[model samples]
Target chain A: MLITRVKKKDAILSLCKGKTLLIACFGCKEVHFEEKEYQALKEDLKTSNLNISGEIQLDYLCNDDYTNKRFELHKKEIDEAETIIIFSCGVGVQTFAGLIPGKTVLSGCDTYVLPGFSGFTPSSHDCEQCGECMLGFTVGICPVTACSKGLLNGQCGGAKKGKCEVSKNKDCGWERIYNRMTVLKKDDLTLKKMIRVRNYNK
Target chain B: MHFTELTKMGKFVITSELGPPKGFHIEKALHEAELVWPHVHAINVTDNQSSVMRLSGLAMCKVLKDKNIEPVFQVTCRDRNRLALQSDILSAALFGIDNLLLLTGDHTTLGDHKDAKPVFDLDSVSLAYMVKHLEEGKDLAGNALDGEPPKFCKGAVVSPCAEPLEPQLFKMEKKIKAGIQFFQTQAVYEADKFEKFMKRVKEFGVPVYVGIVVLKSVGMARFMNENVAGINVPDNIIEELKKDKEKTKSGQTGIEISARLIKELKPLCQGVHLMPLGWDDKVPEILKLSGIIAEKG
Candidate 1:
């Protein structure tokens, strides 16, 4: 599940106008929706003089068929609204926008990152699904997600004392890889075999 | 002179860096280069060092080339995409600049333009690979060049003081495989630590130049320790800079510290790359004190 935070009130208010429809996606079981904060934002929109045509809560806005079926149930409310505000991750916003053409669709939240697996089962690492996985060589620590720059070759010069320069609190991914290699006695092989350039086309 | 030829001849090379002026006027930058040109084999022109916007290093390299000075054109993967980077490489070749220093520059957030988009379309290793392919008369797409292809004595940067030195070594090896002829490391303060790094680096069989960044003051040294990555300014140097605080002779002290570092590191590496960080005028004095050059009569 992707972590996200609500965008600033003024930013959401700017896109909102007459007969605005609010759609909230709260399907991710692991993610908690701040119902109180959502209510507070609704109150804020009302104070800002925006006409609320209707409010709809749906599961998995990113799933096109589900969103399409839900939108059909609220066809009159969807058509009456001048603008649609979706409180979901970027993917869901884009999915909703693609389904409804010629309507002003704006995102009410911005997605941030979490350090866990992207798949359904929780794990310590994430796989960006770059098609070509180097987990076997890198000792299972994914540098693509662990390193801020997603550098595939190795560590950039910014790592210091086992910490990343980009985020001081985060452990340097390469340092982890190095420690793992040493423990497994694979440092020699790592030094000998050169990692090829990542096929970005993948 | 080609840097590759100098290294091949086993010459103890000395190189310094020049940061181009932010404005169009290149007079001051040229003057600074003139100060250390006599003392060093080649001068590296930084590409918006630290991600701060400045005059293009390529333009400064052309200016230096016109002055009959050898320039090591520094290219970073921060600003340009693959197409623009390839074009610039050819442009540098057209201007008769042969030496190239490839770097994965500091992120955009660290620069003056915080909101600017970073384009790491091709990283330092990939860039070196691109250069190798270009030298073979083709682009990365396997297209043939119409005429003579460009040749370069490619160099890359390494961080010797990295906490986990193995990864840096791993990347250095990759760079070597990518046709990088030599390496210039990030600022190294602890000679003992650098010595250890050099011991492993020797197995790679590529020339490694130890980097020496002058520490201007205790505050500056402390700031770098707290902020800059892959750099650890030792307490002894900080204390030395602190001793000069009363007399405001930190600048002199900085030169002395750098010269001392060069002396200690000289035996451990193939050459030294001095990064004066705006104290270009003091490079000559540092070189003389370090015994890299003879004192003027």
Candidate 2:
């Protein structure tokens, strides 16, 4: 149901009667532009545009309130929308997919649009939203985002000269940890503080 | 009144940052202010820290000032245009709160409302100049105010050890030219780095207050390193922190490190600006380490 302008012909050709679609714009602001692009998309249907006949609703969430909303609302959106197109980057898109039970298409915002990478699909049911948000405990580096190996409690020892082994430009989590300790003036005490493994299991 | 006089009179130079609550809980924000009134020299109400809207910084500063805590209003240039920015500065002076910390706040992209549109009114340097011009009874466009402008104890921020320290120093020079009386730096973890930064600028003769942010947890320490720009954390220390987890949980490990930094840096600077973050109660412990008692002068 989340068809891009590029796939408009195919989308209209295979339209189902009772299906509902939801276009989500969260975390990124390029949604305005994306919305504009979709307005200009070529339509091959008899109606010329993919019309949802009032059953479809558009719900948008920016970073401000989206990060803290109740999961029930997100669940309702997913259930209502036959197809969802998300314009966001990184874990936000993936997390939204995890919250909703269905397939979703991903698009990057203008600022986040990396060269050659179009979007991503859910590879596996990776995160089990254990009712705990540990972005703080992890020093802002999500194990799901930066760490390719997905080691939770500790970082992989694969950094050379502050770059990650997998992606040379990517900073190894430990390098960030070291820099953070120095700025806080707790260099000597950095090694002493222990953070327990955050359990995000459902 | 001058900040020096307030400090000299044995009046506690108490300061606090008004973190606007997540919701429309003005009473809760006031309650937070009351908790620190007895100990603060001034309550510094921040203007939409990280550029996310919560409460108006000016209104909150006025509210705290009404409650008898001197308000050191913080103004950042991330949102306002110059005209609005200057008008707000004058309005703050008219409202009677004197202390100010001019900051070039977080980028608009970093905040919750990225699409909310950003207006880089002016950088901290120009803001400092604006403050000076108003003090001289002139507007930014050279128009003179109707009456005598108010005097303010204007201050600015700098991270001496930031990756590129020269720009900060250059800005400091501009602030000095713009009539800044004091400076508070980003948190100081490395006394040696601060000492080196101070050594180069001692000739400026401004009373530099080294920012001392007490690390509440190892996680907090690592968060600052990763997210906060212009902050550098050494490697060996992170390795050590990773190895010894048991001793740090009680926070004694952090306290000791803070005490050591304070003890070393106390002699080189005018005074320490202890940023407790949320841990304001431990300030006394830090004061003890710096050998600074409640000044009776």
Candidate 3:
């Protein structure tokens, strides 16, 4: 599988933390990675006092059966694992529950919101799983997600220049939207003209 | 309307989940919810499911109500003290999301933000009681409401096959006393196990909508077997999938098993809750396979 080695350090640190075993199933495809980048990433983890007691394991599942087998082999151990960290792109993370049976499993995509993930902190407000996500329609950025200020309709004047008024490092929600629009070739639609999205469930 | 009314009519009550995003855009959250409108009987917007960040469940439920779908605004005490908890419940009613699901959410440490503090003011059972009190024109402190209290068809959760069925049964009894009119359980895998579990609790006379999580692949089946609590996947079924691993026919198998379970459990429960797990489009097929129609009523 071609594995891309960007942020290889984080991957290495993740494998080394708070758990006995770290199993990486890259799924059916190869993630592209430059060999040099992979080694350096590995070295960073080693320097950070990662115990490399043969606890870290990586696997490539080219076929579905192997995927099933890998889980079955570690099912018991995984269930008993203090913590199971899954790093798959697809919904495979949701399915992992059946194999190990009993352990806390957290999706990696969600992990990026942690305090350590640079400046991404969860907003003080809670998300009521309202069955709607209004990001794409609102200039390709979800006010609830990308915007730290939580202004449903527009940028919180607090977001000065391009930085969040809440934090200097975080990109203001509007700036992020602007950047996304530029990338998607839809920058012509500015936040000023953005209309309030009506209740979707209604 | 009381859940029994829908049950007596033999309606196929569909429920869907709205997973809140990890941060602050209410507009995006509402728009995403708009996708399943008019399809589900009630949309369950989770309250900090797994303790991850998202838009407020009450806010989302309010948004869902604006869309005219009955919102099951789930409330968990994992992040709030009783004072804030009671306030949010009132806020939910004020916002017009009538239904509420009480939960002791997953620990904060388990979520994306580990540094976040957790506030477990009360477990789900207590929350259920508080809801009942509010419905009875009384506050949590036993004070009377100024006007006629809001009536809620309160619901709580039950896992039929948890190792010690007695604890779950015990909790259910407490919930029943607390005025919980309906129940939706965790995912159901073993039909016979669930049947046996149901026998013990059916006497409560509350209608339970069996949770049928749609399995997309064997990988998913394996994952569920490995991680989720109070759930078990039969080895025979797993082995069967392995034998036909190359066929890529698990989706069909999933539908068949779900349909079979529904057919078997149909007589035992008031309804079935299809947790399509993002495969919402396939729910119709599974329902059809189980001889369930939308009723168009």
B39 Cα displacement, candidate 3 (Å): 4.1
For model 2, the docking class works out as incorrect
TM-score per model (chain B): 0.97, 0.87, 0.88
C-alpha lDDT (0 to 100) for residue A59 of candidate 3: 44
**Model 2: per-residue Cα lDDT at residue B186:** 78
Model 2 lDDT at residue B66:
79
What tens-digit string does per-residue lDDT give for candidate 3 at B1-297? Answer: 445567678786666677776677666656655655445577688887766787888877776787776778888867887678878888877876667777756656557787776654456666777777788888777889888788767887777766545435645676677677888888787888888988888677888988888766777778766556556678876765566554435477777777787788777787777776555556666777888654434
Best-performing candidate as measured by TM-score? 1
For B204-243, candidate 1 gives per-residue lDDT tens digits of: 8889999999877777888888888778888877777777
Q: Residue by residue across A1-202, what tens digits does model 2's lDDT show?
A: 1222222334323322233343434223222234555434322332545443222222333232443364454555556555444333334434444444233222222112223433433332222222232323333234444444333333322334455544556665544543443443332321223322233222
lDDT (Cα, tens digit) per residue for candidate 1, span A99-182? 665455666765544557452423233445453444435554556667766777777788777788767788888777666666
Best by DockQ: 1
Query: How many residue pairs of model 1 clash at the backbone?
Result: 0
